[model samples]
Target: MSFITLFITASMPILKVLLISALGSFLALDSVDILGDIARKHLNKVVFFVFNPALVASNLAKTITYETFLTLWFMPVNVFITFLIGSILGWILTKITKPPKHLKGLVIGACSAGNIGKMPIIIVPAMCKEEGSPFGAVDVCQSYGLAYASLSMALGAILMWSYVYNIIRISSRDVVVEICASPSEGFDDTFKNSSKQPLLPSADYTSITTVNQSSFSSRMQQWLTTSIDKLNLKAILAPSTIGAIVGFVIGMISPFRKFLIGNSAPLHVVEDSAYLVGEAAIPTVTLILGANLLSGLKGSQIQYKIVIGIATIRYILLPLVGIFIVRGVVRAGLQLDPLLQFVLLLQYAVPPAMNIGTMTQLFGRGQSEYSVIMLWTYGLAAVALTLWSTMFLWLVAS
Candidate 1:
């Protein structure tokens, strides 16, 4: 396909996202009052707790197997690399822009995490269905594309909760002053107590030596508990993670796959039901995403530098880096599906994860700032995704 054809193919999915999101934005309007804050919140809960899990489990169960599973090993590594590189760029951005202390985490996070899951669920299959698509048959491409997207969503959740969650938390903790209204009073109290505590608590040298001489096993146990507590394992193993685990179990085991996967299976109804619920995930998430972004238009003023810097990091620089990374990996001898490679590249080019708003809401700060940043980044994403996707399709096809 020509570049123009590829660009059109790529734009269709993004345009659909924009259109659906626009409807969501419209519905969230004051006069419309349909998908308002409370409604979006309830709907988001459904997506996170129910729709997302079912979508992940069903898609993964149908497509993932020992062979495909092994082939996808590099995806997580690629995601981690995006976070690592984005963090580095974000740090540089912080140093240059010197945004407010409270807003620093928002900047880093906006730079670091992309909307890996939701965008792919919409984009990849839509591209596959296009007549000019280079990936084989439409149905096969979509099936595997969804499977790839589900895994991406699950992995993104784990990393977002564990990694990006902490960055925002620590940043929120730094700016917290007086007791204020927040989602968790207990969490704020912990932050307040830690803030008050001295960096090096005064202690007797004898007590220190005695503590150092304590049994290794007891110290190890204490260290393990602290590590787990800091990591927030509960969030790490989120509903989506659980769903992915269930899917992996079903996919990897031949007997389970036979019983639950195929149309002729004795237990196919269960799989069918899960898929039915899962089908709601994509459109619902896109709508919620649009509704949430409505706040960006009405929020407080933010530094244009921060927004522009993060946008450049996410849309321009990251995609270029991703192209090199994917091509290098191929050169190093790992054969990846054309579609898999496309999604990997797509991960780099997407806008920031929407969960940043949730973090700000939980912490009771920077809500306006996050909104302004999101408005611009996502507004620019339509163009960025189209250009990069066009290049990616042409490269993969050639």
Candidate 2:
């Protein structure tokens, strides 16, 4: 396919997202008042628990098999590298700009987790339909494309909920602690004052020894309790994560998959039902994204530089890194399908996941700032994705 044709094909899906997002934004306006904060929240809850999981499970059950899984092994690795590199960049940004403690997670998350799920699912199939597409027959291209997309969506959800969720949760807690702490009770003051205090006058040697032992035991018990509480696996195992897990099981296990997945299966209705519900996930998410942007536009104190920095990392630095990584993977003798390689490359270039906004809303921190960040990244995605995809197609085709 020519670069111009590829760019046109790639931009279609993004344009669809933008148009739906605009509708959402318009509906959220006070005059329209169709998708207000309360409405958006309720919709978000449904999407989070029901629509998202259903979409992920239904798609994966249909697409992934053991053979395809092996062929696409690099996908998970590619996603991990995006997260790792984005994180390193996020950390550097935090150090340089020193955003509020609570926003640290949001920043890192926005940097790390690209919109891996919907974009490729939408873009690749559209490209496959184009006359200039390099990938073979439409049905074959779409089938494989959906498989790659579904896998990316599933894995991305797991990583987002597990890794990004914890980071935001911890950072939010730290911010809360900071906000709640009184000046005199601050950590620095507590530590400095405690260190300067003279040692307790020696009591009877035996009494002192006993007291020290008791204190040590109490501290150890407290530490153990705190550690256990902090390692709350339930918090990390979010609905999306759970969905991904179930999807993987269904996809990888033959008997189970056969029973639930295909048209001929007795229980195919179960998959179909889930898929029907899951089909709503993309439009709902895009709408919520628009509604959230409305809020960001009204009033957001987020630094423009922070937003720019994140955009640069996600759109500029990461895509360049992805090109190298995909090339290296090919060089290392891994035979990835062209469409899959394009998906992998495009993954790096796409905007941050909408789930980050959901996370901030869940935590009640950085929602406006997050919205602002998302607004910019997604706004830029049309141009960014088109150009990068044009280049990626050219590179892969060569």
Please tell me which predicted candidate would have the highest lDDT against the true structure: 1
What TM-score would every model get versus the actual structure? 0.89, 0.83
Instruction: Return the number of clashes found in candidate 2.
Output: 0
Determine the C-alpha RMSD for candidate 1 after optimal superposition of all C-alphas: 7.6
- Candidate 2: the clashing residue pairs are none
Alpha carbon lDDT of each predicted model: 0.89, 0.83
What is the C-alpha local distance difference test score of candidate 1?
Answer: 0.89
lDDT of 1 by residue, 31-54 (tens): 999999889889989998999999
lDDT of 1 at 397: 88
The 10-residue segment of model 1 with minimum total lDDT is 174-183
Which of the numbered candidates is closest to the native, going by highest TM-score? 1
List model 2 lDDT by residue over 176-267, tens digit each: 32367776679788899899988876666789899899999999999999876665566556566677678778988999998998899989
